[model samples]
Structure formats: structure tokens, C-alpha cells
Target: MQPSLAELQRALAARILAEEGSDLDDWICVPSEADSAARVAVYVQGYPARIREALRETFPAVAQILGDGSFAAFADRYAKDVPADLQNLNLVGAALPAYLESDRVSGDLPFLPALAELEWAVDRCFHAELLPPFAASACSGWSLDEWARARVGFQPGLALVCAPWPLRELRETYRCERSEIDVDLVDRHDQVLVYRRGFDVVVESIEAAEAEAVASLQCGDALGEVAAKLAGSGAEPAAVAGYFGRWASLGLVVSCEACPLP
Candidate 1:
């Protein structure tokens, strides 16, 4: 009895990813002296190679840290563990940060997972849909009372990543020079804002207090509420005002709507 088309495809995929459990000699015919298995081996080898290339493109910093040989081995294992399910190849490494954090993939380096997270944010920010920045003139008509109740909506391209490592510096260093991978990993915590400015993706390191305020605003809190929270945390009223203005100037805030008064 012949195997179904779905069965054949499953077997082929299993063989390509795991390099096991499929004998193509029965179904495949080769005209040359080379056996049918040899022909299938070409595709089997190419499968992981393609996945590795995609991973390298997405996580270049991780690849640099791991080196070519180690990265290749890591990519092979990752490919086998998490096969690409989406039609788009760029989404292949979406789960890589989590995989790196797993105990299964142990490593001497502790910052690899955080670096992967930062790289993935860059990739995502680059491809995110562009929305026209909110016009500053829109705020001209709001009264002091109305402003208190306003809720600012962040841009779709905005991403806030709080990491235990100096991810922004690490990413920039690797990007500037792959050979210069020496970075001190102790006592460095970074709150990074990843967003697209026009055509470029910008990753900026922010102060912890500012990150807290931004996170509160992003969560749909009213402006007055955020200001109060910051004030309670020892931030002055003037400083809170400046922070909101800076975010607006940076094109981070998209929409500012006054919450309806009850």
C-alpha cells in the first residue's frame, strides 16, 4: 500500500529536521549512479542550513557571542526543536530567547537570553507598521482639567525591554564590531526603549524612573495618575512634566485622549 500525501510530507519533514526515520530510497528514483538517499540527503542538509541562515540574520549578536561553530550547532539544535511553522522565514527565531532561557540549552554565558530578546525587538521594530505621529497641535485646545484625565496611546512600533544586562551597549558593540565582544556582565541593568523613527529602528537606554513612568502611561493610566505615581516615587512635578514633554518630542506618544468625566 502506498503512503498518503500527508504521510509522505510528514515523513519528509521529520527526516529533514531530525535526520531520522525516513527512507526515501523507496519513493525516490535517481538516474545517476548516486543512490536516491544521496539525493534526499542534499535537501535534508539544506533544511537546517536555511534555518541557520535565517537565525543568523535575526540574531546576529547571539551568533557573534557563540562563534560560528558553536552557533551552527546551536542553530541545528534549535531548528530540530522548534521547526518553522510560519510561511515567513523572519518569524523563525521568535521563540529563540525563551529556548535559550531553558535549562535544556545550558551555557556559561548568562546574558545570551537577554541579548536574544533585544535582537528580536530590533527585528520586530524594523518590520512594525508605521503610524503617523500624533500632531503636537492636537494638545493646544486641552484645558488644565482636561489634560489631567488624558490617556496617551503609545505607537505600535514602540517596545519597552527591561533587561538585567546592558543589552543596548552589547547590541551596539556587536553591531559596530563583531570582534569586540568583551563586555562586563555584572551589576548592569538596562531599561531600553525600542521603536522605529521613520525608516530606522532606534534603541535608547532610559533611566529606571522614566521607564517606570513610561510603562505606567503605556498601561492606559491617566496623566494625573501617572504624575501622582511618579511624584510619590520622589520625582518632582517639574521633572514629571519634562518627562512627558520629552516623550512627545521623541514621537513616542501617538494619541492623547481625555477620559470622559462621569
Candidate 2:
């Protein structure tokens, strides 16, 4: 009449994740003086604590902006709302940015969602693999037509986050290692690029045209299509070329695929 090991595991999981009454108490043993409910409570409390700690580490700026008390409260609510990804605490904060978009905290600080997004991007880039520097000489023989027809690939660590807020300044102000300073939170379109350069992650503001071009490329658009879109947006003829030039110099570019003209 005893529950199987698999059944005990299922019940224990339900107990930890939520307030689901389970007969797991009947399975786990403890000191005669201690209770099974106390053992279950340890896991119930520890799991959320571990998740909050991971989120704080990954989103130090957000945590600083929210302050210790508010961040803790929001993290607990998030733990309840969003199921942990792959049961890994390290990946728990992956949903924080989207979760903040609708949370009450965002109502007070309108930039919270974008800021969290940038932080997440930073974390991802730091963890991404560093690819070998791409050789630009590979395209020396390509004509303009060939270049336009090509689909460009970028480094694995590249990520673009666009927001209508001065995101870079805000991120630096509360960044983990910095003194508090006044930062103007002017509402303006900010296109931020995050990529791993050498051994460190670089987070910098980029021009709108560049962000647009990179975004198109990230979407798998051909270089000519990206150029046409940029032209429609009033970007100069040389603007698309400039983007590629800069990207190549920075090692952001990885490869280019162009078919020979018939």
C-alpha cells in the first residue's frame, strides 16, 4: 500500500512548487522529534531563495533600481507566476524582462522592462562562446552586386536591444561596480548593442540606422534588401557599407554567402 518512488517524487515536486497538499509527508522520514512537514518546508523555502539569488546576480542593475526589499518581493511573485526553465536556477531570470512589462513595478519605473532586457542580454553575451575573428579578405573579390546579394552572419554573442529610453546611461548608473551618479532619464530612442569583445562583454549605444541594419541581417535578410530598407529610411548610400565595415572591424561579422551571378 506504499507509494512508488516515482509517485513520491511527483508529490514532492508539487509540494515545493506550489501549495498542493501531498501525501509526500508519509514517504519522507525524519528524527522522531522533527516532522516531515518541516523537511518539506525546507525545500519549499530554499527553492525560491535560490531562484531569487540567481536573478539578483544576473540582473544586478534591476535589483539595485528596485532596492533589496522590492526586488525580493517581485522575485517571489515571479517565482509563483513563471515556472522555472529546465529546473535551472541560472535560467530563472530569463522571463523577468517580459514579466516586468506588465507588473506594477514597471508602472512606477517605465524603463524597467527595457533595462531588464539589456541586463539579460549582457548576461547572455558574457556566457556566449567567443568565435574566431572573421577575415574580411575573404570578400576581396566580391563585386558590389555580389556583396548586396549576400547574407551575412554575425558573431554568436551579438544581440541588439532597442528602446525608447536612454538605456545605456541608466544601466551604467546602477551597474554592480560603480558609484551612484545622476543620470538623465530622457525619453529618447536608444539602440543598444551587446556583444562579447575579447574576454569581456561590451554594452554600448549604437545609431538607429546601424541597429536597423543589424536587425534586418539578424532576420536573415540579404544585404541588398537591408540596403534598400535603409535607403527608404533616408539613410545615405554609404550607410549600409559603413555598418558592414564597422561590424567587420569589430569582429562582429562571421561569414557571408554570395552566389555567383549567371
Candidate 3:
């Protein structure tokens, strides 16, 4: 009996992704004169090649760091291990950072996963929806007590990434200057703020405290709780206030809502 369409599709997909144990001839048909295995191999080879190009587009800095040859190999391995589950090619590399962190590829380049994460964040920020900034006038009417209960909402594109390597600087160096990566620079921790302003995606280095505060806000914490937590963690009130002002000016905060009265 002939296999169903779904079964044939499943078998072809498995073969294309280089999964083991799929007999190509069992699912594919070719003329007696034509090579069935060779035809299947063509699709198998093209799958990773297309995915590699997409990954290269998404992670130009990482591609430059790893170079063409190495990046191609890495992309091939990643595609095989984690097949593209999304219909959109733009999101194909969504699992790449995790793949890099897995035992399959993490041994040689410990920093690659973090670097991939930064790149992915930048890509996401560029495509994320834009919303109007929270009206500054709304804050003027709030009493100190009312302000404490307010929760801040961020723009859709905002992403904070904390990594042991200086991912932001490395990304800039590779992207802007096309310079060689410095191995010594990966020794320290760094936090990056990624967001879109107008048509450009901006990547800025931020202090650890600021990253934490933004993370808290992103998690729906109220201003009062975030402030108290920051104070407990050794951040001065003035510093926190200043950071909030900066964030507001940058249009990172898109909405503010007061907590319900108890």
C-alpha cells in the first residue's frame, strides 16, 4: 500500500534535515533512468544551505567572528540538531543560541551562545511593534504615593541581555569596524540594552543595576517594589530615579498604569 501524503512529507522532512534512518527511495519517486537518491540528496543539501544563509543574515557579527567556513559548519550542525519549526525564515534562528549552549557546540566557544543571543535580540528589536511612549504629562499629576503604585510598561522591542562576555562591544567592533575580535575582552561581565528607535535598532551598554531594574519592570513589578528592591541591592534612590528618567527619555517606557486601590 502507498504511504499517505503526511507520511511521505514526514519522511522527506526527516531526510532533508539529515535525520538518520530515512530511506529516500522509499518515499521519493524518480524515473528508472534518473537517480532517486541523488535527487533526494539535492534537497537535503539545500535545506541547510538555505538555513545557513538565513542565520548569516540574522547574525552578521557572529558570522564575521566565526568566519565563513566555520559559521557554515556551525549553521549546518545547528540546522540538523534543531530543525526550523517556524514558517517564517526570519525566526529560523530563534533556537540557535540554545543550540550553541547545548553540549553539541558549547565546548570550543563558550561565548558564542551569548553572542548569538545578543544578535537575536537585535534582530527581534528591529522587527518588533512600535508603540507611543508613555505620556510624560501623566506623571505630573501623580502624588508620591500614587507614583509608587504605578507599573511601567516597556516598548515591544526592548530587550536586556546580561552576559559574561562584552557582547555589545564585540558586536559593534565586528559590525562597525570589521576589526578582529579580542580574546582577552571576554573575561568580564556586560549588560546590553537593545531597542528600536525610529528605523534603527540601538544597542547600548547599561549598568548591572539598570539592567536589573528594567528586568523587574518588564516582569510587571510596580515602581515602589522595584525601587525598594534596588535600594536593598545597594543602588541609591537618586541613581534609580536618574536611570528611570533616562529610560523615559529614550522612549523605552510605553505605558504606565496605577495599581488598583485596595
Look at candidate 3 and give me any clashing residue pairs.
none
Clashes found in each candidate (C-alpha, N, C closer than 3 A): 0, 0, 0
TM-score quality measure for candidate 3: 0.89
Candidates in order have lDDT scores of 0.82, 0.86, 0.83
> What lDDT does model 2 reach?
0.86
Question: Is 2 or 3 the stronger prediction by TM-score?
Answer: 2
Model 3 ranges off by over 4 Å: 21-23, 26-37, 176-179
Q: Provide the global lDDT of candidate 1 against the true structure.
A: 0.82
What are the clashing pairs of model 1? none
Tens digit of per-residue lDDT, candidate 1, span 93-194? 999999998734346877788888889989998998877777889889889778888898877878888888898877766565557667887899999999
State the lDDT at 155 in candidate 2: 87
lDDT string for model 3 (50-117, tens) is: 99899999988788877788889988888777756689888999998888888445577677889889
Residue 208's lDDT within candidate 3 is 82
**Superposed model 1: Cα runs more than 4 Å off:** 103-107, 176-179
Q: Following a full C-alpha superposition, what root-mean-square deviation does model 1 have from the true structure?
A: 2.1
Task: Please give the range of 10 consecutive residues that has the lowest summed lDDT in model 1.
Answer: 102-111
- Number of the predicted model whose lDDT against the real structure is largest: 2
